[model samples]
Target: MPWWSWILIWVALVALSLLLYVFLGIRLFRQFMATLKDLGAAGKKMGHISPLEQAQTRPEAGRPLPGSAVFASPTVMRHDYEASKSSRREQRRLKRVQRKTDRGQPQALGDLDFT
Candidate 1:
């Protein structure tokens, strides 16, 4: 009814809202901590399987494990190296061509201007 009474009611509402926010925040924080603990426990359980165990385990029912090459010859490595080097060189050439095109540069004599 009065101005002082309205101010008092507003203050009470603000205080109650703040208290509710604090309570909800604390509860959410506790839940988040519990979730983190559960995640840590799950991680620990997962960590029990070592890298060797994973490598030994068959991923498929019938297929062999991947990257289990028994013999890697020098010729095979040299071929792979040459292939990768050629691919990189091709990529660099393509990037250079793209940059020239982006800058409106001509690639051939027909594209040159004599004016």
Candidate 2:
């Protein structure tokens, strides 16, 4: 083939590839938009129902429904809170002691002489 013919063929192939790319991109964008619309509709439907109503409708095997207390009694909850508070206080005290000990120790690597 002549040089000009070869150039023309190359140009036609590039244009065809560009058109194919744009067509596929538009098709994918439409599909994504449709999916987004479906998700929005589903979200709106979910929003219309109250959480309590939804919880009451669904049956869970092992778990309690929405607002029922997990603990047996108020005293149990209070005892749990008090235990957690004491544990946290002890952790803070230990960390304070650790920090003081760490500050008193020398951390310099220069003190060791390498011959």
TM-scores for every candidate against the unseen true structure: 0.48, 0.46
Which parts of model 1 are misplaced by more than 4 Å?
56-62, 67-115
Residue-level lDDT of model 2, residues 12-114, one tens digit each, is 9999999999999999999999999999999998888887777668666744455556646888667767887988886876676667567896433433325
User: Model-by-model lDDT, in order?
Assistant: 0.79, 0.77
Candidate 2 at 70: error in angstroms? 7.8
RMSD of each candidate relative to the true structure = 13.0, 15.6
Estimate, for each residue in 1-115, the C-alpha lDDT of model 1 and write its tens digit.
8899999999999999999999999999999999999999999999998899987776886333466333667787677668879888868777777777999887655333356
Model 1, position 110: C-alpha lDDT score = 39
Enumerate residue pairs that collide in model 1: none
Clashes per candidate, residues 3 or more apart or on different chains: 0, 0
